[model samples]
Target chain A: MWKEWPLVAFTIAGQMAVGFFLVAGFPLFLLDGSHAVGTTREEGLAVLAVVLGLLVAAALLSFFHIHHPLRARSSLVNIRTSWLSREIFFELVFIALVAVEIVLVWGVSAASGLSRGVHVAAALAGILFLLSMIRLYMLETLPLWNQAYTPLSFALTALSLGAIAAGFIWGGIFILLSLAFVAAEIVISFLLAPGHGVYRSRPTPSLRPPADVPRYLHPARLASSLAGLSLLGAALIWGRGRAVEGLNGKEWLVAAFALVLAGQLTGRFLFYGLLARPGR
Target chain B: MVTQYGFFFDAAACSGCKACQMACKDRNDLEPGVLWRRVYEVAGGGWEKKGEVWVPSVVAYNVSMACNHCEKPVCGLSCPTKAIWKREDGIVFVDTDACIGCRYCEWACPYTALRFDARTNTVSKCDFCFEAIDAGGAPACVASCPRRALDFGDLAELRKKYGDVRQIFPLPDPSQTEPALVIKPHRDAARAAERAAEVANWEEV
Candidate 1:
């Protein structure tokens, strides 16, 4: 399972990228059809570039999950029946739409007016991409991942990370949402996940370790989650105490992003660790 | 006209010597970790008190399994590259040429029929010995069983001969993939669930 690290990185990075875009870009669409904001158009372009870069990097990393990279092109051949194929299809579309939106708004003239439409389209594609990613794991055969927890955890990761990234600009509302998501994730994983373990059920059991195995939850994963939430909470308090200033929250947000990202990576690692055959 | 072939297992007659598994591995030349057909040793139940005596209530049996080549194979449906496909005779085959080695089919198959081949960086499984079947010969596993505990034929005929029981303890529900196999269950199977029986030999399979 640890060998599948590339997949863990791919999914978390891709989800964070989408979350950042949705949280940071939505306000641009809401601000009365004007491009004016505290940050320069160049800065907005930089943010979009960051999101695009993360997604592209994620796509590249996912290639490592396949043993034969040359045959990766054929992954989309079964979109009709395969969630994996649909996931790749939607991810590519999301990336393309984001690229075009960036070009229209930043590379070309802002007077083109095509940027907003493209941004909206890109967001829609991102939503679909996220959905496909969630559905890919909600397989009936593996009851552990087939629950509401998979989708919920993924969505929460996006929301929390995105909110923290945009928290200073949006004030305490985004920060509050981030905390709420984090708290909910902790509650569910600790409280509700035990009953789902494989040894506990027959036909609808959760994914678990093989026989005579020890340790239900990995210590590293739990530690990472604690560390991440602590960093985010510290950032929240720091931002709340400081007077609003341009780029003041930027540094803290970056710190929060790095720590949260670490937490997400470890969490995803544990998620893959749950992969086990039912009988033995 | 979609002719389906299947295997029939008489668990009552099996002796758990693993001849079928060895025969399959030998015929397919499987590597150390890759097994197309596996025999699971199911054992459970502890000491029980029966009024005036303490009695051992252990129940044990062996289930020899391979790809059932189900009617609605989740492995094929979940393959992103369409690498796993079913023949006209309902035998599932992995197109190693097209497989990207994502191992999603391995996760999707409840029977865990698919096994990774590190040498090829792809997955392979039982093809129902299609080459021998086409030539009117028994599969190596079937022919090798000295006790004649295993049989193979058309799904309809196997059902007629063996009755409709397709699942035993630790085996998943048959409705998931509509596997074409049939079984004459061991006597211990009825009490397996109550006794908390599970597949015991994990390292070998």
Candidate 2:
């Protein structure tokens, strides 16, 4: 299970990139409308560049998960039926769209108007990429990952981390959004807590009883998440208290991002741990 | 019409010697950690009190298994590169030439049929000894069984010869892949779940 670190990095990094991009781009979509390059355009382009960098890193990390990285081009061969194929396809599409958006918005003056449409398309692609990632693990054979927890957890990872990353940039308002995502995460955690280790129902005939999801990992994930939640709460209070000369709340948001990202890393590890090695 | 190939297992007769498993390893020249076939030792129950004294109430049996070359073949369906494919005679083959070595099929298969070959950096599994079958011979594992515990043939023929007992204790549900296999379950299997039986041999397989 620990050998799956590459995959862990790939999924988490990709999700965080998407989350950051979506959350940061929200202000642009809401605050601007005209074809003219707004004051925040440079900052927005810089943020998009960061998102692209994260995606490229994710794509590179994923190559290490497979043995023959050179043969990765063929991975999309079965897109008609395979979720794995669809996932790679969507991720590439998201990356390409983001890169194109950056180039068109900054380099080509004539193509400036197409930037919003491209951002929207890229966000949609990011969502599809995440959905495909979820679907890839929803194997009925593996009851541990097939549960509703997979999709819900993945989506929340994007929202929570994205909101926090956005808060790091957009500052004041996004802290509230981050808080909402974290709250939703806590609610879902509570909902899934009851069936943490037990496989009460047999979805299909399993060769052996479904191995229990690690009891130890859950507490660690919960602790980190709750700790991050507390920090975000503090950050909110700190922002309000330190609201002097145009405070964007970058001070506390960075720490919250680290804590939440660490929590997500632990959770992703636990997710892969569900497929215990030397499987029964 | 596609002639789906399959396997038949006689849990009652297996002695847990692991000859079939060894035979497969020898024939395929599998890597150190790779196994094409395996013998599972199912054990459960502890000392139970009788009228006067404690008696050993262990329900133990051995099951030798290989890929069943299923009808649905989830491994192939989930393969990103479409490297794993089924033949006309229902034999599933992994086209290593095309495989990207992602190993997603490894998780997709419930029977744990596929194993990663570190040497090839690709997934490998039992192919029903298609070459030997073409030359009018049995699979290495089936032929190597000392007690005639394993059998192989067309799925329909195997079902007709043996009863349609596809599921047994510690074997996955047949509906998942509709595995082309039949079995003669050990007597203790019916009570395995109630007796809290489990596949005890993890290190070997």
Candidate 3:
């Protein structure tokens, strides 16, 4: 699983970028002219630019997953049939759409209908990108990853991290929402663990005896996430406006983000660890 | 006619010598961890009680497996690059130049036949000794099996020669891939799973 760091980094980073975009844009589109949780045009561009940068970074990291990076051009050759092809294709589409959003936001007001339309489109594309990612892992031969928890866990990863990151910039309310999602994600992660056993959890094929699912790392990941949730919850209860990094965000929020990120990283590594067999 | 190739294994006669595995590795020059053909040592069953007397009823058997070259190859169907494909002879081959080394096919395979070759930086598997087959010779593994446990022919021919019984203990359900394999199971194979038999060697394959 450690050897699959490239994939772990690629997926989480990509999902995080998409999550941020969707969560931040949700209030804007859902409500009629709601800047209540929106940033200024310049700030929007800055945020979009950051999201674009993360998307690019995630794409670049994924190159490390394949042994022959140069041959990757052929990956799109089978999008009609292969979920992996569809995954890469959608990711590229999402990235391109985000770049377009960044440009449109730079050119016009954030409140303009055209910019908003593109923003909504990009968010949908980001979602398709995530759906492709989920399908890519739900292989029939690999029962460990084939369960319902895969989609649940991935959806939570996107929503929890996205909601939390959005809360970091938008408002205290988003933080509370993130707290709920983080708690939910933690539960889904626990259920996804093979040893959780009561569910559809099946042992991955292995040459060795059945594996102990991340003896130390699994608990540590859950602990960090729980701590993040607690801190964020406490911040909503106590801190009104501390002004983190000149932004109307709490310092505790930033700390919680770091802790949550660490938890997600560890959890992803454990996810890869589940692949005991069925080819590799 | 579209000739689909296949393999036949007589598990009743196999002695688990592993020569077929070695022959395949040597022929393919596969890396240390890569195996085009593997022999799973399925052993299970325990003592049986017969009217207050204990009888040792252990079941053990060897199953030599390679690419079954399924009619519906999941690896090919799931390959993002279309790098894995089947010949008219029903032999699945990974295109060296086209494969991007994504290895999604590895996960889709039921038989665990596709192995990542570090040297080529791509997934590879048994070509069914296509060159040898075209020249009217058997695959290295089939030829090397001293116990005369292995055979190969057209899928229909193999099924007709040796009844179409592909599933046995430890082997995945045949419907998953519709693999072109025929097996003559060992007598103990019938009760292997019920008796708690499993592949004794997880490391060797």
Candidate 4:
């Protein structure tokens, strides 16, 4: 399952990118809202660059998942039926729109209506990309992935990661969302996930055993990751009130973001490790 | 009318001998760890108490399977590069030239039919021996079956020759892909699911 690192990176990075865009770009629509305070054009552009850069890195990593990188261009041929094709199409569209919006904002001005329009367009494309990505894995044959939890967890990952990365604290809304998502992910991992059946107290007799137990699935490591995430969420919420002398609020926020992102990365690794093949 | 080819397996007659499996590997020249055809040994249950005596309630059977070349092939529908496709003969074929070896179709297929070919850096699977079929010969698997438990012909002809049952224990529900293959189920098949019977062999194909 570790062999599927490319997929794990691709999905997480892409979803985080989408979430960052949505949270960071929301202020473009609020013409006279004070809640958009501290939401500057430069910060937004930086986040956009990060999202695009992550997406490009994700695309490159996906090439590693395939044996023939030279034939990667042909992956877009089956848009009529394949979710994978739609995913690529929407990702490209999202990237292109984001790039154009960046040029408009940087070359023109942040207050330009045209850049806002492009931002909205990119957001729509990002949503499509996320949907396509979800559908790509919700295959009926693979009982392990064909569930509502897949999309729900992915969406939550986006919301939580994106919220913090975009610096949208929202009077502790981001922290609460992050905690809630972490809890939901824990619940899903133990209960709703198809692969969770393997670790059941009385596992049903199946063709194959739980393929491999990765380090992240170890009880100790799982608990530690969850605890780390909870502490990070608390720190983000508490650190906002107690300002360190040298460390600015943004620095603390960045630290929280890095920790949470690493936790999510480990969670994704465990997700891929649960190999539940149909027959054998 | 398009001639949709298919296979018919007499599960009652099969003796678990892997001649068909070997014939297929030999015909395809598959490398180690790659199996185009596999025979699944379904085993489950144990001794059960029947009043005053312990009865052997155990059940076992074998299912030799390859690609069914289903009418609605999920592998074909799921291939991002249009690498997997079905001919008018209903034989599903993989285009190594187009396949990037992403192996998404491997997950999509219920049969576990697709195997990664390390040598070619692509996915490979049973092609139903279309070349031999075009030359008016049966597939190597069918021709080599010692018990004559396997047969191949047009889908309509196979359906007429055998009953309409297409699914057995450990095999997925046929509705997903509408697999063209037909089967004469083993006597223990009905009880297989109830007893949590599963494919027993893991190491060998």
Candidate 3 has a DockQ of 0.56
In order of listing, the candidates' clash counts read: 0, 1, 1, 0
Interface RMSD per candidate (angstroms): 3.6, 2.8, 3.2, 3.3
- lDDT per residue as tens, model 2, A129-159: 9999999999777766788888888888988
Error of 3 at B71 (Å): 1.3
Clashing pairs in 1: none
Write one digit per residue (lDDT tens) for candidate 3, span B3-62. Answer: 899999999989999999999999988889888899989887788899999999899989
Model 2 has an lDDT value of 0.81
Evaluate model 1: give its lDDT.
0.78
Model 1 residue A191 CA deviation (Å) reads 2.6
- Chain B TM-score of all predictions, in order? 0.98, 0.96, 0.97, 0.98
Error of 1 at A190 (Å): 1.9
lDDT, candidate 1, B1-205, per-residue tens: 4399999998988999999999999999988888888888888899999999999999999889899999999999999999999888888899999999998888888888988898899988998888999999988889999899899989999998889998987777788889989999999989888897777777777
Pick the winner on DockQ between candidates 1 and 3.
Answer: 3
lDDT of each: 0.78, 0.81, 0.80, 0.76
Task: Point out where model 4 deviates above 4 Å.
Answer: A29-38, A168-173, A193-210, A215-225, A241-255, A276-280
lDDT of 3 by residue, A1-280 (tens): 6878998999888888888887777667554553312556655776687778888999899998898899888889898788888888888888888787777666655677777777777877889999999988887666667778778878888888887777666656677778888998988777656553323244423222243355788789899999999877766655563223333247677888889989998888877766644334
- Tens digits of lDDT, candidate 4, B1-205: 5479999998999999999999998999988788888888888888889899998878898998899999999999999999999898889999999999888888788888888888899889999998999899999999999999999998998888897999888778788899989999999988987887766887775
Kindly report, for each predicted structure in the order presented, the TM-score of its chain A compared with the true chain A. 0.83, 0.88, 0.88, 0.82
